[model samples]
Target: MIQSIKITLFDERTLSVRFGDIIIMPSAKVLKNAQYIELGSYQYWPVLVPRGIRLYTYEQVPGFLRENPYITDGYRAYLTSRLCIKSLFILSNETVNIWSHLLGFFLFFTLGVYDLLAVLTRLGASREDYVIYSISLFCFQVCMLCSVGYHLFCCHRSEKTSRRWMALDYAGISIGIIGCYVPGVFYAFYCNNNAAEICSSPKQMAVFVDPLRHSCSPPYDIHTFVWFGYCLQYWRQVYLVTVLAMMLAVFFAQIHPHYLTKKWQKLRSVIFCAVAGYGLIPTFHWIWLSGGFSSDIVQVS
Candidate 1:
């Protein structure tokens, strides 16, 4: 015998389904406002699956969520925090964007554990190396988690919640930039004197002033070495302090009401790009100090 089914909703609370010769009914309390769809049948009983979640098109969503016109469909809208978390399992346009960053968080977190337990241990890494690696990886993980949270919760019913997440996402980007700068600057100028030791040793200073020594007297050579070492250390501090200040400025700027609006989109991009591009200043300086592109350090790096 051929099997067929029909569904009827008598009111907001009553639902009935007729499958072949069998009739099924759900109580008002159980069926009130719940959403579901029938999926063929098993033996004589019809299978029902919950589908309370809804997906919207780009134009149908709110203005803030309409950032991408190219993504024409598959948007979750008007959801509460509970529903937002529930939607993580639902397949939608943001599925990849959300999962990718989530996975990245896990990847970085795993790498951090391995670095501390195995990689750094094998390398006989110092306390400074441990601190740097921890900071860089922690920033990466924070960046990933912030991006995931922003994307996952951007469709929240409250605009304020969405904007807050957006601000956090941008701040995470700045932190990630710091993560890159810390290690790059640290290792790039690893041989140079730190703030505590402006003049490491006469032997190291001699290496720095060796070429100039033949061109000058002993006293002049010593003076030049001290001056050059102090200058290098000074610039290092300046670069780090500048980056920290820029990060703080960006964080404070994000507090502005108009910062996250579409009107300031380009300005936002420009700010981030400028912050990232600032790294080039130290990069070129390092190249110059390493004897231009011909030096072994510059060439290998």
Candidate 2:
């Protein structure tokens, strides 16, 4: 950004000036015919305001962060989308719900890059281990946002509008739920598809261990049996959640109104709650997040 030479107001004297982020240009003179100066790799432009342009702060922030008209529109829209989706917008209640999840998207986008880098570096990246787990997690977050958005906004319109949006919301939940396991299953068992061939019993079918590359599986005599049993129980519940969420989405979205003998308005609360609840099952993220889950942190051995 080049420094402005200052405005000639009363005495027609040029004042030397340097501005960091924002400037008020006199609109009638400089703004009407101002040309952008090209400085090497940058083109500099300034906001021209009417004489005596007064600047006000937004939300207690300083400079262009508040006064830059061009910048605020994007953040405002982001704020609008997020703020409106969560039953906040009487006109578009889904706006806040939609936006909160969208903000979450920025979070996951960072995680995705970490995933690929973890794999290439081999940083002890395991499937269930969490690096590649990001893909599934991100997918579900997006779907949940869409699902919540649809349900929240659908009610704002007419009956036909409500029906369509509700159905779309249900489908989003179904898609998200089904995708939830992909990362865990894929990352946990990606290299061990061959292990499936060595199974001896139906109980042994639970032996989908990745064996930590060079490390031996836990001693199968006792520790292995204990973990296997624990994991089997865990896996069953996890799978059941996916299945149940899917069934509820499809069945409720299509069949519930048939027998409930109530308006869709009556079912709205239950539907939104269930959809939101299914998305919450993935909250184990807090644990993985807290225990140094980062691309920079890796197991040395």
Candidate 3:
């Protein structure tokens, strides 16, 4: 028993044991492969191994790679199928995808905080504008964070955990798309004369509008033309439904086997572009209905 318990230190990264003058180096791979060692009649268990030990192939990596088979097929030239926390910092194919979004999230988060304390607090900017801007920024943050988490942990061995992370990643994208619409609609609806009337009561405003501050009674007028609250609400409801439908489509496309094919992969870019193009309809409508258009509005949209 005493002899079996003898420990030996090898190179800086390795630990071993001396059993009857023979040293056996212990490692994660070794422990996983050989659970125990027999010294005479005594069986000794090795210490637990830390995770993030090595990389694997598409086949070797855990969970169903069917969602994105191309990920491991040299499509992501820099990607390595790494596992655990090590995957977070590694230079895998997802390295850029992960870091870009992570950095973007932090950037937006810092800007959001500054905007609240500086612009909104000082009463220099419209509170409604600030609220709408903040919502967009927050949505971008959620999207980026979700992308980072998905890229980092998608390589996990547990299929269940990986699947949930993937779902969250898709949901974040949906929310972010909706966020992009927030400021656009806000500015369009409240442009010109209606801008001052944005502080309408909650019931008078569109459901999506925050009702941050109550300023004037409805019969909200933009560009000297009167627009009833119900009319505005009807359009807002349509916009909300459209956004929800797009998000559901994105989510279902990711999960459905039919849409997981290589052909669908090529079509995905077109789908995203089409969705983006659809957003332009509102911008054009705003310009037409307001009877005026400006480069500023174009840039915001």
Candidate 4:
């Protein structure tokens, strides 16, 4: 039997009612034309859904939002913060840019959780491995989120808001680069004698454990562990420090007033390219250290 019924109206002809255990909603036609629709309810508040959100042409947007002349239509501009967020659901030119990175954030976040729970645990990952994986995946998530923020809010009425998000996007890129370097450097010099020497000082016969050694035994008589006597530890530190310095330099450079301006566009590309290209230096050095291209380590890597 139906007890008491309660009804809430979102707009004309669009109402939701609850009768005991049953819920009733408005028809799809009414919902389509609803003036104020409730997306969902949070703990204490209903989520606001935008109504009659309008799209504009490239020329209709403000100068700051006119970065892409090729994209002539379907631009959302002159929107308040609330409206900017609502625009996430709307179909617009920036929708791809926004959703792609948003999805990327979730993907990396899922991978991080999986690695920590299953993959890392199965491999008997050390404290350092856990830390490295966490940092790398976290950086990736940050990068994705920053990109999503910039794309979503770039349509804000205030140019200042958009520019701040852009700066954050750049910072996120730098962080992601650092994440890549951490794991790559750690594993590349995993068995380096100099690194082992530095880590376990006064212990000449230290048994340096390589995580990869647990899986497949190498062709060396030293069991799964391979001995290396090169100064790779020095080069490893040098590469990391160099990358950090370069990232900092790039970060500070973006602080300049004209850094984001179209006038310095090519210069910005060159700067980022240089920073990324610097990795090739240590890569080639590693190949050389491992006895060039034909070596077993080089081939395996």
Candidate 5:
């Protein structure tokens, strides 16, 4: 006799599976989760696993032997690559990390649009100020979105692919650090020094910009300063601080594995706070040196 199976939908992304002598209710959790079955009896059926399914040891991770020595054997890992982007919405240990940044991207995006429109619609808003604000905002959004992708897709089938996502995550960190510098540097340069004279310098160059720039009439033109002139800005000091901060972050990420042991797990949160705090050092230093903070620049930066 040929054995048969039947499936019933519990919801849009969940269902119940009935085999010859067993009935299994697969939860929505199976979205990012993996499952299994008896080798010979159900060789043709899909294995529907629940999210946070089975915890995997470093050795159990194919190609992970001889690596991540610091990691202990008490963590969950997906064993298969059957699900692609669908896995992103599923709950897992990485669920918080992924959703936090994804939501943050939306927050920054909304703020960027609102602020940009506010500046352009105003009668006396400075065009340079708007450009600086937008650059900073765009950089922040890219970084956040990249983080979302990294955390969500880092569990792909190929270990090599997972490593690539890690690289992208680092790139996002670098770009975010650079973005944090743009406005802070621009404002400190023009606000504390000679704006009119610097505007006329040969360093200012015109470039293609968003349609939003047309509202200001000339589009966007950024002043690419000379090495000496650029170095003079207080934000460069901030950039240096940021570089150090990023280096520290990368060091922690590489040397200390977050998945290693429960005792060192808190390092993840510490690293995040430390990088953010380090980025603030230059801002505070500038405020002290400049005698007071420029509300406009500080607000955006």
Candidate 6:
């Protein structure tokens, strides 16, 4: 009697897992709703378990991980990982979220490098040492970088940890979104004190771009004022305002409530969906602003 794994579709996109013995597959609307069907001697089966999402035949999946499906062992790992990731971000727990954000921090670091090198070529930076000023952009990038990392790693934390990490994660998102527009705002409006500021600068600076693949400079005719510290100071203000706004929205809604059991799962889903949809506004703004409705530059994603 050789033992083998049994996997059956439980819904349109889920699986009920059994080691052996029983065969039960019902068309249930609620996937992962915890309905187990056992048959045969029901004792013939070595051990029965529920898999999730993708049903992987033991032979198909990697041997080391084949034992763990979306449910069962895999589910626990997923839960732990998921919880930790969310938690770390809220509390600012400083593991995966922080670590992941750190990765983004480095990316902007490189972008600054490019900006600095480019400045060196063009007669060694104007007043305010625009080359070093690239650090401001880097700073904003850092915020986004941290936010992203938090999102990934916060899943590993305990409940308390998850709450704090999620808050921090929200803060990080606020920071990132605000940061995204800082460089443009600073460079665009630094000079013309008389007129309401605009972010045409990012587009303007883009003109300087040559080795386009590597160039990080903004395009169009951007001109920062000599008094503005090359626009670094302005972005700091942006960060403060953005963080505040993000905190209010995230907390006020009680988005990450206590006890994320099956009950609140759907609520979480809705919140996430809403947040994601809201995020598209800026994204769409960026593409629209960048392309300016230029059919050539824009493509539907």
RMSD of 6: 15.0
Model 4: per-residue Cα lDDT over 84-170, one tens digit each: 888898777889999999998999988889889999999998887897688678878878988999999988888988887887788
Q: Tens-digit lDDT track for model 5 on 1-301?
A: 3266886544334456677777777564664454422222223223554532433445555563325545544233443455535556454456788889999999999877876787466756676677667777877887898788777666666666566566568657756776777766565544324533544554531222222233232332343233223444555655655554665455446434332345756765675566567656666765544334543334444
RMSD of each: 6.1, 15.0, 11.4, 11.0, 12.8, 15.0
In candidate 5, clashing pairs total 2
Candidate 6 per-residue C-alpha lDDT over 33-138 given as tens digits, one digit per residue, 9 for 90 to 100:
4323222222221222233222223233333333334322211112355443333333222344456656667777777777677755577656544722653564
Candidate 1 C-alpha error for residue 88, in Å:
1.4
Where model 3 places Cα greater than 4 Å from the true spot, the runs are 1-52, 66-83, 191-277, 291-301
Q: Is 1 or 3 the stronger prediction by TM-score?
A: 1
260 in model 3: Cα distance from truth in Å? 7.7
Ordering by lDDT: 1, 4, 3, 5, 6, 2
* TM-score, per-candidate, Cα-based: 0.74, 0.35, 0.54, 0.68, 0.49, 0.34
Global fold similarity of model 3 (TM-score):
0.54
Rate residue 272 of model 1 by lDDT: 86
TM-score of structure candidate 1: 0.74
> Who is ahead in lDDT, 3 or 5?
3
The TM-score measured for candidate 4 stands at: 0.68
Compute the lDDT of residue 252 as modeled in candidate 5.
Answer: 46
Candidate 2: lDDT of 177? Answer: 57
Per-residue lDDT of 29 in model 2: 57
Model 5 / residue 204 / CA error / Å: 25
lDDT of 1 by residue, 47-149 (tens): 2324355666666789989887888777888889988887787677889989999999998988889889998999999897897778778778878988999
Sequence-dependent TM-score of model 2: 0.35
